[model samples]
Target: MVKKNNASNKSGNFKTNTIYAGDCIEAMNRLPEGSIDLIFADPPYNLQLGGDLHRPDNSRVDGVDDNWDKFSNFRAYDDFTHDWLKSARRVLKHNGSLWVIGSYHNIFRVGSVLQDLGYWLLNDIVWRKSNPMPNFRGTRFTNAHETLIWCARSKDARYTFNYDAMKNMNDGLQMRSDWTLPLCTGDERLKGEDGNKLHPTQKPESLLYRVIMAATKPGDIVLDPFF
Candidate 1:
């Protein structure tokens, strides 16, 4: 049986709004079982980039080529995904929920593992970027969207869902799975010392705002492993 620690009862080991810097699986294992309520993950999408991409202006398009996005093979990536997801599941309460965002490179794989680990999927949302970057080479159609998978620990788990709040946000209409939100830009995006964008995959606050408003209450203990 899962030992669910409700938010009203405090635990010394867990701290809200704190980043425990270490391996994701290791860090999550340190927390008490059934402690977290909502978890939002933006894991590395192992996009195997063959080469660099450039725009019509000749400026190189700095795609997601970071070392973190690299995995030796599909097997290695799957193992990594399983480990972190297992830890996340253990730390999640019986009624807790998790949300993961990924591209075609890994979302399907992650979804399979989530089900294997007993996570009952709620919805697969498509975040259509209102201003997505154009495919410079035009080798394929513009990849203008990403998918977010929302799930509970199990099918029977009574999870949080503010349907009325969501309806209100959507102007009295039921919210659709296809969200047309823009990517993180302008002041919302962090800049480094050289005045370049710091993080390559920064999710916009508007996107998360809708997520939180729809599925979680104000005091819910939301855990973001990599957002």
Candidate 2:
């Protein structure tokens, strides 16, 4: 049996719990087929980033140079991506949906793979960081946002969508294609014992809160494949 940890909001609001660690593909395979309500994947960007990067201002920027982010090449990366996506689709309920986030370096490839795998596209959301890091090298326009693609398991599946909750969270405005939010900062961010960032790419919880509130309902099981 998969062990689940119950997670609560600061106000004690309740919902389906979560699992902290494991190979998500193996974990998903252990689930009964068609069991998950939704999936949110924030896979590696395949940036091929190397070494530590710092700004002239002396602030250190966490580049994604982890071994897990490495791929021999695009073909290898695509193969890995396709394999996991197949697992995700098999575990998702027929009426369930998926959300995947990535930068320009990988989103196009991911979207293409989704099409090949038969996942029906819904909306592609752009998360625009409110305080994006500037291009200190001044080589190109600062990469300011990441893209998230929302899709259903198949064309005819009836996916869960919390329409009202999304509207409220957007402050009554129609939630646009682009979302402007701050990157993880300060105490809300996890840190290592030496005071460095915990995970080089730990996603913002507020971003997740919005995603869950918008895409799922209470009791709906959400699977984070790359969590």
**What TM-score does each of the candidates earn?**
0.93, 0.88
Specify the poorest-scoring 10-residue window by lDDT in model 2: 6-15
Spell out the clash pairs found in candidate 2: none
Q: Kindly list the per-residue Cα lDDT of model 2 for residues 1-227, writing each as its tens digit.
A: 55554232112222235564556565555666877888999998899776667899877776878888899999999998998999999988999999999999999999999999999999999999998889877889998999999999999998887777787878897777788888998998899899988787777887898788887877888878776
Query: What are the lDDT scores of the predictions, listed in order?
Result: 0.89, 0.83
The runs of at least 3 residues in candidate 2 whose Cα sits more than 4 Å from the true structure, single-residue gaps closed, are 1-20, 50-52, 57-60
lDDT digits (tens) for residues 1-227 of candidate 1: 32334333343477766556666676787788998989999999999998988899899987899998999999999999999999999999999999999999999999999999999999999999999988889888999999999999999999999999988888999989999999988899999989889889999999999888877877889888764
Clashing pairs in 1: none
**TM-score of candidate 1 against the unseen true structure:** 0.93
True-structure RMSD, every candidate: 5.3, 5.5
TM-score of 2: 0.88
